[model samples]
Target: MEVVQTIAELRARIKTYRRNNDQTVGFVPTMGFLHDGHASLLQKARSQSGLVVLSIFVNPLQFGPGEDFERYPRNEEQDLAVAEAAGVDIVFMPSVDEMYPTPTRTTVSVSEVTTRLCGASRPGHFDGVATVVSKLFHMVQPDQAFFGLKDAQQVAVIEQMVQDLNLPVEIVPCPTLREKDGLAMSSRNVYLSVEERQQALVLSQSLQQAKTFIDNNVSGSFTSEELQRLVSKHIQTAPLAVIDYVEVLSYPTLEPFEHSHSITTLIVALAVKFGKTRLIDNLILQVRK
Candidate 1:
């Protein structure tokens, strides 16, 4: 309900909350153009903490040169309504100048774990994510933070960063929220034209096909070369969808599994292009013991 624009003002407000014995604060950091997935995170945060702080900053540091930083959607009024509906107490929407008065020299990087999946495609993306998240963590100093599992790799990267850096906050991973047709909700979904949006369903469909392959006791256990092949086949069915990467990785580590039987928890993450809009979706498959 309350919007704070500057870092100092936001910090002062949080300090006041802490001084008043708020005890637990839940933080959800996001770029604007929020959707149900983001609202889901806020709802979870609100349920767990006395004060829920949602920061909406389109962090330039996390974007690559050719990325859609300029066009990344924004609807502050709508986002505030959504946050209030989700029971957020404070919405911290800081300006770029407030977040970075000068060029940042220090960067946070979680090596090895960040070298694959989304990281492989978006070079230095995780470093940017880690840096901004670290700054937010310090500024908010929340007892808990919420992230969507839709950004599974990002979740892994942040969890690793927090552990390595000894940040005193619990990282909560919320389940991915999906549309009725099965596409994972994303802010970028706004970029999709009607036809492209239809085509984008392939990303989720492909993952579901992979899940079916696993459920059927198909040839391969977890690393069914067949599963990968089938997903590719489904994706190719959508001519407009250009495959970025479709992979099955170990859940938390994100290391690829060569054999299906060897995988305990498999993450089927994919990025694809429908027209010029790049969309991502994934399915987490847990192999039964």
Candidate 2:
């Protein structure tokens, strides 16, 4: 696999691939720390497109003050090896200075979907996500972009931005990858101590309970708030886990919780802090009667 740091070279390479209409291009956007979850996205992209492009840039815009931007994991050698092994054709690793030479006043923001859950917890988080994704989409100009469902809200935000702007690309949502013990895979998992890692299981456990409840109540037996409380209560049982937010929202709309409505799908998600490490996990329940 080839690694290119400058945008001009990356754009030129993609431009060459684009010239051939018969050959479709696929893109996967990610930060540097490579993991199985990221590998899964690259593999999916490889299977769907003739050529795949993976980008590794820990977008500064996405991190809020006091966040882990400065210290978020970074191992380019390992990340590149993982991407190459997953069949990535080209890897775009750009420097922060190269991406944003001068902090200008342009931003790409989406509404409603960015108001709750992770968005609500981290102010301006989704704005950073939407803006960077928009910039990447414009620069790479791929036929399709693959994303994991691990960040359901992030996926939703990007989809909205693409449709609203009429961007010429397809956003493909892939399933979330997890550990053998059911903990959702994340780069931050490295930050967890052995004891805290065990406590982290509370996240997946709570989500699984919510999923089971929803499965049994396909006829719409529970209110949104009721289901949320059930999940929150379960997570709170773990002494080391501090509940960030446990939410149940309408599928794609991510509508605010209120009275129950018979719907086809519901997104159950949560964020919990295991000491200094914060982990997020989500499940999508499709009502089947």
TM-score of each: 0.97, 0.96
In model 1, which residue pairs have backbone atoms overlapping below 3 Å? 221-260, 222-260, 222-261, 223-260
Deviating ranges (above 4 Å) for candidate 2: none
Q: Candidate 1 lDDT, tens digit per residue, 76-153?
A: 889989998999998999899999999999999999888778899999889999999999999999999999999999
| Strongest candidate by lDDT | 2
lDDT, residue 224, model 2: 83
lDDT of 2 by residue, 183-263 (tens): 999999999999999888888888898878876775766788888889999888889998888889889889864655666
**Model 2 per-residue lDDT at 105:** 82
Give the C-alpha lDDT of model 1.
Answer: 0.89
How does candidate 2 fare on TM-score? Answer: 0.96
Instruction: List candidate 1 stretches off by more than 4 Å.
Output: 218-224
